[model samples]
Target: MTTPSGDPTDHEHWRRPADLEPGQPAPRPAAPAAPETPGYQGPPPTTPATTGWRPPTVVNPMAPRQLPSQDQDSIDADERGARTLTYGIAMVGGAVLVIVICLLCSRVLF
Candidate 1:
């Protein structure tokens, strides 16, 4: 492949080297000055009046608690009903899938 007229490796193509004299070094620019500002003072401290307000109490999740006897019976009954419903749906879906497979097989045979 042919090389371009302006080769990057050639020092004459560089801006800094071409501008500076052979013996003299380039002059350094002055550092920027920081702006003057007053020290930061945070917002004034506040103390809320306790006339009627009260902080919320925290509950311990690990603590063992007892449920009312009637509520426990109701919960057990609900779980049983849900399990019966899930089993009934699964059985109905399986029967439908079997019937569809038999119909397809019969059609192919005939």
Candidate 2:
């Protein structure tokens, strides 16, 4: 049998399995001699289809980023100020309660 087209070695038109050596360049994929179509019987079309079949690529859409609201900074500042005022008031109340307790204890002992 004649060797297939594009094959480098024409020796005996065929190579035994053991005859091939290692590190041989990969053989190119042979173009299909016939194109498959459903229910069509005729001489394969004269014009080759310009484009080949391609699988649809999956595109990862980027998520939209969220920016801070216009009032965020002002709201944070107001909350911090309110916390500071509440802490100051609590400290003053605790000091007054301690002084009152000390006076009552002294009076009871005397």
Candidate 3:
């Protein structure tokens, strides 16, 4: 069968499985034919223009300002307090969870 473009190979005849007899083998669709026209070849590459080496210039001339000093002892104490608070909260949460589980088990059993 010819397609709308008038290409004969584009719509080669192939019988459906239902159309064949019970013992008859099914036919494969024909492979597409190669194009008559040559494949596309894009524009050729060109080398880029180059510039000579240039000396680097300093953007800022002023000396960098110093950061404020931190009190190591105070920082250590704050870290210790945060760690203790985290552990206390975790313990309280675990105890509440255990109490809830025990209550649920007692209710189910009784």
Best by TM-score: 3
Taking the tens digit of each residue's C-alpha lDDT, what string does model 2 give over 9-87?
Answer: 6564545456456767656679878966688587876975558757677997889999866898998999999999999
Residue-pair clash count for candidate 1: 0
What is the Cα-based TM-score of model 3? Answer: 0.50
Q: Which scores greater on TM-score, model 1 or model 3?
A: 3
Residue 110's C-alpha lDDT in candidate 3?
100
Candidate 1: tens digits of C-alpha lDDT, residues 47-110:
9788988777797468667975678888999999999999999999999999999999999999
The estimated TM-scores of all candidates read 0.40, 0.37, 0.50
Q: Is candidate 1 or candidate 2 better by lDDT?
A: 1
Model 3 agreement with the true structure over 1-110: per-residue lDDT tens digits: 64366656764444355679877787788999987997777878887656865667868588988999999999999999999999999999999999999999999999
Stretches > 4 Å off in candidate 1: 1-6, 9-70
CA shift of 15, model 3, Å: 14
Q: How accurate is candidate 3 locally (lDDT)?
A: 0.84
User: How far is 15's C-alpha from truth in model 1 (Å)?
Assistant: 21
The RMSD of every model to the true structure, in order and in angstroms, is: 12.3, 21.8, 8.6
Q: Estimate every model's Cα lDDT from 0 to 1.
A: 0.84, 0.81, 0.84
